[model samples]
Target: MECNKHNQPLSLYCPSHLMPSCDVCISTSHSKCNGITSLASVVEKTKIENSKESVEKDINYFLSILDQLVTSKSKNIKTGENHCIGVKKSINEIRKEINKHLDHLEEKLCQETDIIWNQEKSKATDFISEIEGKRENLKEMKEHLQTVTTNTSKLQSFLGVHKIEQQVHQCQRYIEDLENDERTKEVDIKMKQNDEIENIIGKLVSIESVGEVSVVKTEINLNKETSLRRKAQVKSQEQSNINNMTMNIETKIKINIDKTIRDMICLIDGRFIVVDWHGKVNLLSSDGKLQKQLPIPGDAYSVTQINEDTIAITYPKERAIKIFNMENETVMKVIKLGKLCNGLSFSNNSLAVGLRKEEIRIIDLEGNTLKSIQVQSESYLYNLVYCDKRVIFSDSRGKAVYCVDDSGKQIWQYKQDLMGPEGLCIDTYGNIIVVDFNSQRIMVISKDGQDSKVLISKEEGLVFPQCICFNHNESSGFICDYYGTYLAKFNLSFG
Candidate 1:
């Protein structure tokens, strides 16, 4: 420790002010203080006063309080959202009930209308039948009178004519009676809507809104224990500037394989999953030692971790993506694709796959596509990373890196001269760490893609650098070279 006044090393302590001081401070600030002790003696006495277990207990107590607060607040948020969803469901149920009742009333009215129509038709039909019968009777009597006049005696003709006249008179009387009856008038059907139902419908339409919800006051108890625990992955207090950072190689571990290394990813526990071009995946320890080799058949182009135990890989030749269980070392599921699939990224429980064509498909685990973005790249895109609704990928043939939105609209692109950009990863400060296969180097581009700097050169023992990944804290990282050669472990520092 140093002195604030003289800029000299501090070795003495002022007990009155509880401050450490140098010689200059002792003569100036501690001149009036009594019993100023040496800092070394004070440290020795503190070893007994502040034990390691007691300090740990104090830290644990603070952590417990913070954990409870976070859990209760998160639970309350979820509870409030669920309550809103329940209220919306109830509203839909009410609308459904009203519709059901209206449908029943409509059907009943239709049946009543039909009954009235049938009754009117029956009355009109009966009148027509009675008129026809009377007319036929009169016609038959007249024909008998004509036959007596032509072939029988005068007395017979007279009687027949008299009977025909009586029959005609009766027919005329029946016609008159039909015309006099009110039921003989032309049938006219009319419809009348119920006034009560129309008024109810108008009332419903005039109302502005459904209803309002009652608010309940919530009280959060920070001391209470919560069932849900929060995982606090606290990082170092020092912040890093993307513009001023350094990459220093710490160790280089040679791999036993000979094929080309295509892609790699850093795991949660500081391990790595690297893939060879020939369908082989190796799980390496934090120190770059081979722990296990996962038996995977077919050409694996890219790989991404869905979780600690699950991983998804794309097979170009197979035109599919296979999910593997790292714990069991078995293929759990396979998602088939019609086009050739290359790059892979797991986001929001779905895979964002880059096809050999000009399209990128977002699909679920069951191979059902959720979205497809059509890029305008002329070359084939290989490695990619998806974050913040943005898809960043590299086109090896085009020698360019692209940043595009979810709908494939261009944001910005970085083109390194004759640089074969391969796999890329995002750093803690949103900078992009991309490797160049042809240049045999590594580059860190600003998150905006407006500026870039060559972080690692080929002279630093890098041969055909293919993929790069950093740990969670960006304290250390690994750079994999092509041809399955080796993994270079490096310590990362930011100014």
Candidate 2:
């Protein structure tokens, strides 16, 4: 019962940390925490009849869930094994008809089948092992639960119940993650043999195997409980607004290529079409690695995804937009704009271009003008995004962000604590996330453009962050530094 550090007998419980702390601990580390009292007082205040029963009930509930997950994942392993066996049988049947010529082909197909099946099997085994580990954690706490309850000591029961309850919540989040994960679903092994291969094999001397083998992943929702749970979670967030949302940095990639990234767009397929102010247009992988670089050799300012197979990049110096086929990285057509384009955004088959003047041009992919929105600011550079029938643009010279309608009217403006604003984006919940060049931070402004919070700052290692974009699914986002060699990928989560 002595203090761990100051050697003062542990006399107080910190409900925030779910622990018993000495006086010295509370004065410093636990200063901001509330509800500090003697451990015995916690049980008295909460009016608990049986903390043991309450916590044990939660443990049992989670253990049942873990048991279900173990059974389901094991079944997927069995299903994949049976599927692979069936595929191998077909390969052998072809071998019987084609004789020894098909022997090598059959062996190769079976080996390929084993490889694919084993990969899935390993995934299931690993998942089951992890679930079992969680199960063991609950079981250990259950054993300790008896020790705490045996003496009828309020201090022991209070602390035990608190720790075990925290474990229950951890287990709940883990189960929720399993429900969202694709690996929890059934993994189907598909190896189709070409009938022509068996028929023409005897006629021809040699050929390239029977058919291609692949692991076909199904999109079926594995857990209905999870599906409904996710819907409820999303609905709960929808009840509020993005003002209640926040972000956590998930991944960081140091761009190996030396290019100044001005703006970037995340596509539906997790790829990025990024533009460099230094005359380079590159296709980047989800991790910010350079995949392919277009040979435009012009000072590109911004890029946007126009369609699944097309992208448009604006070269301010050239005063033109290049519509290129993303498949081949070749220019399909050129849409010449007489004004300098600083940023581009596409929605509803229309393009919104930010020019050097106080106008925002709405154009189509075929270079037809749709609508031009007029604003009060005549800034030289404007970076903008179009979403929900509103054009959210950043005026670099004004050091502010503005929301406008298509009919040349202003909606709202955000102009506080902003320093050298550049690229901005509207998140799924209509919150505007913008990166600042001079402030070296990122901010999340409310949809009404009234309230804003600094989501990240230079204290968080941001060095002139210029562009910020969220993925289509809203699960992840990326921030590009103005220097172009560093990108921060963040996980987007909402209450």
Candidate 3:
């Protein structure tokens, strides 16, 4: 067999369309098919015996047969065999006593002889009737088998075999039904111990006395311990009240950019690096003053601090990460990413970068890709953070935040009404902070993604906050507004 289009022997199969193809066809026609696997691997996995449908079908057939047989046998079987044996022993003991008492001439004369003879005669008649019914069924089966053997046409013989099989099954079912009938069951009699009388005698003998416990009171010592407990509780209550009270927050403009600032990172020295939509990486002073601006190759989408003096900016459209040194204020290097790089984070001496196709890649300083984690999502990952050996990222289209370990295994995911979740960061308490641009709020979630609450909202004068970053001050964060062009600095509190 050969491929009609390629005019070569079919050596490959395209799983996308389930078509056999030649090597030339595979390279030319089905080059972009991700599901195109080797024909040998497909055959080895999907043979007739090893196929999923075949295995399921065989298992279902066997289970059906076993289920029917078990049901039929259970109907015919007796459950309380041991109980019946005990009952029979008791009945025989009573019979022996009855015989002993009736062995006297006077007792025999007093017995109802007619009634006893009638009962025995009725049981013998019923047994003879059952034997006659079985004999008749056997005779009918023999005649039917002989007629089936003499059938002429093949179709008639096949139908006759099926009919005879059904008849035999029917007969067997009739016999089982007779055996399980109440009238056919063996009778058993038993005399049980008088449990009521035993319980009454047991209650008469026991008289258990459990004494009441009491404590001698000392007024002064008791009062002292109570006062100390009250003081400790009041102190604990004061601390808890402090934790629950909202602080007098202060918001300041830490940085201002003329263009749309997409992301910001706080360096250890109190300076900040902000990347704008116009592909400008700006160095800002601690109090919102633009110190210097460096022009990069493409539109810078995200910026992350790699060290105390270096920051990396991601250009999604250009598929490159430009690393810049803050002390010398120069572009150190640019790593070329083959796919769209949306988010950049530093952890374990590697870059945790998010791609546009919902995947996270770990790359070293030398640009060598270490491992790639597919997020298994339909939405694009816009922002991510590396913390606690977990890559927590936000999917704007999916409207969710996902946490995955280094091996691409999912730890937990939190989904809420997040409209365009863009910037992601982890606070000092390890809580995930996300910026929802449409909702104009900052969402704070626990590390495990279980507890989530709004940290900042539109009521706090945040207008279209796009990016978020934790500050070095520990309890404060920087949020950049896309439309406002100014960063909002606010103190973080739990209440």
Model 3 TM-score, 2 decimals: 0.50
Computed on alpha carbons, the lDDT of every model, listed in order, comes to 0.79, 0.77, 0.72
Off by over 4 Å in 2: 1-240
Q: Tens digits of per-residue lDDT for model 3 on 4-74? A: 87689877789777787889988888899877767777776776754667668667766776677687557
> In model 3, where do residues sit more than 4 Å from their true spots?
1-249, 254-256
**Residue lDDT tens for model 2, 91-151:** 8887777676568888988998999999899999998898799999989878877787677
Order of candidates by lDDT, top first? 1, 2, 3
What's the lDDT for candidate 3?
0.72
Question: Pick by lDDT: which candidate is best?
Answer: 1
Off by over 4 Å in 1: 1-241, 416-418
Q: What is the TM-score of each predicted model, taking all chains together? A: 0.50, 0.50, 0.50
**For model 2, the run of ten residues with the poorest summed lDDT:** 226-235
lDDT of model 3 at residue 384?
85
Worst 10 residues of 3 by lDDT: 206-215
Residue 452 alpha-carbon offset, candidate 3, angstroms: 0.9
